[model samples]
Target: MKLLRRRGAVSLDDRLAALEEAADLADGRLEAAAVAGARAVVSRAGARRSLSVDHTVAALAGATGSGKSSLFNLLSGTALATVGVTRPTTSTAQAALWEGAGSGPLLDWLEIPNRHEVDGTAGGGPEGAEGMAGLVLLDLPDHDSIELAHRLEVDRLARLVDLLVWVLDPQKYADAAVHDRYLAPLARHRDVTVVVLNQIDRLSPEAAERCLADLRRLLDADGLTGVPVLGVSARTGAGVAELRALLESRVADRRSWADRLAADAGAAADLLARASAGAGAGDSGDRAGAPRAAEPVKAPETSADALAGPLTSALSQAAGVPLVVAAVAKAHRHRSVAATGWPVTRWIRRFRPDPLRRLRLGAASAPEGDAVGRTSIPAATTVQRSQTDTAVRDAAAAASAGLPEPWAAAVRHAARSRADELEDGLDRAVATTSLGASRRPVWWRVAGAAQWLVLAATAAGALWLLGLFAMDYLRLPEPPVPTAGEAPWPTVLLLGGVLTGIVLALLSRAVAWLGGRRRARKAARALRASVEQVARALVLEPVTEELSRHRRFTEAVSEARDEVRPGRG
Candidate 1:
């Protein structure tokens, strides 16, 4: 059992390693799903210990009246189990332990209580009888029984046993069920199974020999050509000693367990190979058409370029400036608004229209009462914005359509299911990539608020100063005038506030610009990573898996060739 466990662990480790490597090379949901499937296979394989010594059980399965129980008794050298004259004698399983050196622990694990001590001191029946160790023989219910439970027991134990010694009587040696269901299904396990024409005492020597040959032919038809078929009779003890020697050889070498595990591993590898074959063709095309190739084709001012002229034109119109004058007008507006000037006049300028707003760009119409006293933008701007959105959507759809059927369906499902996440990723990527960090910072809002407050204060101070100067210059009634010095105090406060606000706003803009630059760099890196991930999953990973499958298939074909070659040894 421990040896079996170790072998299972090794197989599981190899499978897990392969899966991890594949996962690293893959991408997206396919990578995740493949990794999950591989892990499941590994876990199941780990749970199954192939041909363990603790389970060194061999089922004595045969047709009714085949003397299967008598043979089982002969092998164990004990009549501990009942042998009935009825056709379907053994209705349930009865295990017998062959007590030899190192057989105690194995038998205990197999839970077989009936034991027989085959002594070299008294036994003259077979030479080399001492070699048979750790063999637990099970007397299974008759295979040809009408009772469903008997057949079920045989079928169940057949799968769990390390070896199977199928017993057939002369009367029913060619039973269809025995050959088709039992023999054919286990053709792959030929090394660990044997067939015996039991109760051969009823047939003549010539008839027995011919029956054995026919059985071998049947086995060959079932794809078990190399498996041994022997004629044996429990009553005469004919060929029982030779069968015992074969069993002894199996116990001595412990090669059956290795052979069984190898067969199972080969089967699992075949499954993986088939899956790889199915995925191979799709991988080739996807690799050749990766998304990053679009970048060079869409480069600035190139024939393939579609963004520069349209984007610039759209932004110019949106900013309410003529396409040629938008850049210059934007600079002038910034200088005029930000420059320090006489406190009273600057306060009055706060009520004037922003130059950008005055250019009348943006949506077709500005909001009624919420406007900055600007006219509506031109109709062409709205049309251009709509066109840009449509173009982007159409391009995305076309790209999605070009994917393979299943993959395209999967992409569509993902897009629909995770639209919000995709949108967020796109927005973040665009903003960070296109806008430098220095131009957009959180502190800008605070700075803008402070600048407006200062502007209001300056305006109020200028109004007070003007009233005081007017009263003195025109000799008008000084109605409720506080003092002449009060005007200077307001002017000083206004000037100080304006200066501080201007400095803070300039600092905020600088910080915003720096932040935007950093964000843009980060966005570029993320986009590249995303593109690479898609390329690997859609192209490289599938191709590698397919190639691996093809190589394994070639190796299997080569092995089959070696197995079939005449006198290859």
Candidate 2:
């Protein structure tokens, strides 16, 4: 029968365990000031290990002139808390400990210096007090006291008590200070809270009912919909039994502390959950309604995969991959033209520098040590540097778009974690990439040999013609010069060799231009791949790890938040 009634209610142990988990999740995500109340709940719950579970600590709290002390005395059946007609009574919190329970450590933790034992026959009828053996009733200073210290004492004890019985007078039942400062904030804590219209004897039955109705409306507006409200007169003892019965029921349960702490954890978790929802919706200032589902799940809007393209592109540009590939293509054409051009002008072309060697980078320039070495390439221009920085920041923002502030900050940190090493790392990556332009093409060697043969033929023909002219000039007998139909053989050989070499050089230049473009494209692809690898190692990996941490934290906090159902057990 008990299980059926408490089917959906979480056990005390489960609630405490969940509270512990939630507290850990809130450490950095929520501000320490914002989460202080929840941390106090966890700390008090742990402190309860040394306290007795059988004891129920209840406090009577009210604004000035509310008869809170009279109610406290009536409940304890003793004059422990002083009563006065003066505006403020009970400057410090006073506890009435029933004799059967040991509350030494509990009172010490409560920090109440004034305590009275109310279990003996001297105070009143022992039978009534005997039934409330494990109860510890406290009379707290007026919440609206003129003395700041008295109000501070009330505020302090208000948080430590297991159950709060707010005592209000008929006239001041709708006071803004009480409802705004206390009741509204404790809306989620209604399960462990009660409101009593004290000194109800001042009003007739109809007037009492009307005041109660007005108070109920205020409570509902304050977000305390189902909290129990009663009417009682401490002076005439009318309706005092009902208030005592309520306290007795709380004491009998022996789970008031657990329920209070559980509700506290729930309220704190709900605040965080709503804030996160508002952030995910892109309106961080909005106050989201209470979570409707049992489990609160956060599906991050931006994933690591979505960050790859922008990050890689930025790193590629930062690494000077485009400039390096352009140099490779130019160098390939320069070397090819020099090797396969006509021999007459090839030596002059050699005076110009190889574009790749000018940069001191290529497959040949990789550093020998594990430390990344800088390339001798020229520094990026101011515009290029600015663009790189902008790209990195944009990628970080894109990767953190829908995440909570903490997670977004984490992603930004991860993206820039190795920023100082990026210039050198990217330079090293470019230096190590294979340009494929290093190996000379076989056709260049063959074409060079052909050019040399043409040069030799041209030289031989010219020498034969010079010998014939010198013999004629000396008036000596000359050998017969060969003839090719209408033209002299020496002149035809000389012209054909020079013209053929020029034509071959022109053809090779055209082929080199086309092949150089293809080589440039290949080099670009290879460099981009290397740049992508560098991005993954330095930037994407850390962002991915942060995302994983965020997912785990969300799940843990969600589990804790889901465990504390406000109206449920």
Provide TM-scores for the models. 0.51, 0.77
lDDT of 2 at 350: 87
lDDT of 1: 0.52
Candidate 2 residues lying further than 4 Å off, grouped into runs, are 1-32, 35-41, 99-102, 120-131, 273-300, 303-306, 335-350, 364-369, 400-422, 439-515, 533-557, 563-569
Deviation of model 2 at 418, angstroms: 5.3
Q: Supply the TM-score for candidate 2.
A: 0.77
Task: List CA RMSD, all candidates.
Answer: 14.5, 5.8
Q: Which candidate ranks first by lDDT, i.e. highest?
A: 2
For candidate 1, which ten residues in a row score worst on lDDT? 292-301
Candidate 2 per-residue C-alpha lDDT over 1-569 given as tens digits, one digit per residue, 9 for 90 to 100: 01122466555455445556655655565455434545666677678656776788888899878899888878777787788878777788888887635788888888977888885673336766666778888888889989999988888888778899999998788888887788877766888999999887888999999999999988887778899999998889888877777777888887787677666666655555544443321222311222232233454566555777777787777677778888988988898889999999888988998888787765453556755456778777777777777777787787777776766777788888888877877887887888887878888999899999999989888997898899999999988877999888889878988998999899889888888899999989888888887877888787777666667656545544545346665
Candidate number achieving the greatest TM-score relative to the actual structure: 2
User: Residue 435 in model 1: shift from native, Å?
Assistant: 3.4
Q: Write the per-residue lDDT of candidate 1 for residues 457-508, one digit (tens) a residue.
A: 7777777778778888999876664433655566675576667666755565
Candidate 2 lDDT: 0.75
